[model samples]
Target chain A: MHRKLIESFGIRVRQCREKRGWSQERLAEYSGLDRSYVGEIERGRVIASIVTVQKLAQALNIDLADLLTNCGPPSGPGRSN
Target chain B: MHRKLIESFGIRVRQCREKRGWSQERLAEYSGLDRSYVGEIERGRVIASIVTVQKLAQALNIDLADLLTNCGPPSGPGRSN
Candidate 1:
């Protein structure tokens, strides 16, 4: 469940970045995070802190709520939203 | 800016917990986190990881997006939304 949660968040980050036509490197640059770190996040290799989440939201020009949408454990018993 | 951001998140956590009339210890128990850790999060002394945030939101019975509302840096210029 934890793994799924992290992976979903990474997917969300990638989706938002791609929507903006920005590369991972571009996101790193805009968010003042390391390129490797951004890559790790997108790959779901790291558990990002709230501060990191805020930086990503700011760089992506999205609200924190929007950035976090659909990024947690499966909502319902049989399936997730 | 980072300090303010963490502080706001802490404030939000405190508000939610209080609204539910749950003590910090109860929040920790429900979230499966250490009591001290929950206290730290509520005091703005730590930058909680995504997992921690998820746990808290689940324990509070709130959506992640709703839990994060008003938890980041203020919006707009000179004034925050």
Candidate 2:
């Protein structure tokens, strides 16, 4: 996995959660994920499944696109989109 | 996992591939995935990780958001986001 991309994604997720005044625990509760797992995600320690990403988007009351809009570098050749 | 959502995502992936006139094998080649795995994803038989999704999007020359924009039902309450 691309470490930088994962870190960017984690930062975006954390920012979104904070914007809603939700803790990792609160976000986990709403997303049906474990609190520690959510923390891991925020720290870019885990590669989340698409379903997990969708769950987080829903819990944040945002579109999945919105959640990912600012994540990572711009699309480029020879890299994962 | 949510069956409907997975199915919808599969359909979207299939549509995108077809739009580019690429077969599953071609997509797999471009995305650095196994052909059978690509087929499984198109059939909604497995839940893809975010890294996998990014790879496919990159191979398809599209954004991850575009791939997921029309997937599944609208966001609803009490469901994994």
Candidate 3:
């Protein structure tokens, strides 16, 4: 898997899950993923499939776009639109 | 490919690329992706690899997180952290 994106995604999964006051076990159940797999995502040990990502996004009620872009902040923070 | 995410990504790639004043060919070159593939992304025809997503994020000087989140705004749009 691409290391940076994987790692970035891990951090996000953890941050979002924790923000929701859910433990790994709860999140795993809520996201319909394995607990160990959730841990893997949190640890940056795996790059999730699109279905998995959608499950996670759905479980969290967040747009999939939020998961991809919020690592730190944009360097060029200007709106091109 | 997860159809929704891929299609969502296509729209985003198109919106962002145009916002940057980049042509499909220019974005393809800038992102180190093929022009046809860039078009695929713009048109939501395929899902990109992590490497491809990274390249596009880099070329846009935007955070990967931004790409994932900015889909029509979050329902609640609150900060967890």
lDDT per residue, candidate 1, B1-81, as tens digits?
A: 778878888899898887666788888888899999999998999998889889888777776767777433222232111
The runs of at least 3 residues in candidate 1 whose Cα sits more than 4 Å from the true structure, single-residue gaps closed, are A70-81, B70-81
Docking model 3 quality class: incorrect
Residue A21 lDDT (model 1): 65
Model 2 CA lDDT for position B4: 70
Q: Write the per-residue lDDT of candidate 2 for residues A7-45, one digit (tens) a residue.
A: 777899998787666789888988899999999999999
Candidate 3 local lDDT, A1-81, one digit each (tens): 368778888898788777666788887887789999999988998767555777776666665656654423221322111
Top-scoring candidate (lDDT)? 1
**In terms of TM-score, how similar is model 2 to the real structure?**
0.82
Q: Report every candidate's CA lDDT.
A: 0.78, 0.76, 0.69
Candidate 3 runs further than 4 Å off: A19-21, A49-54, A63-81, B49-51, B69-81
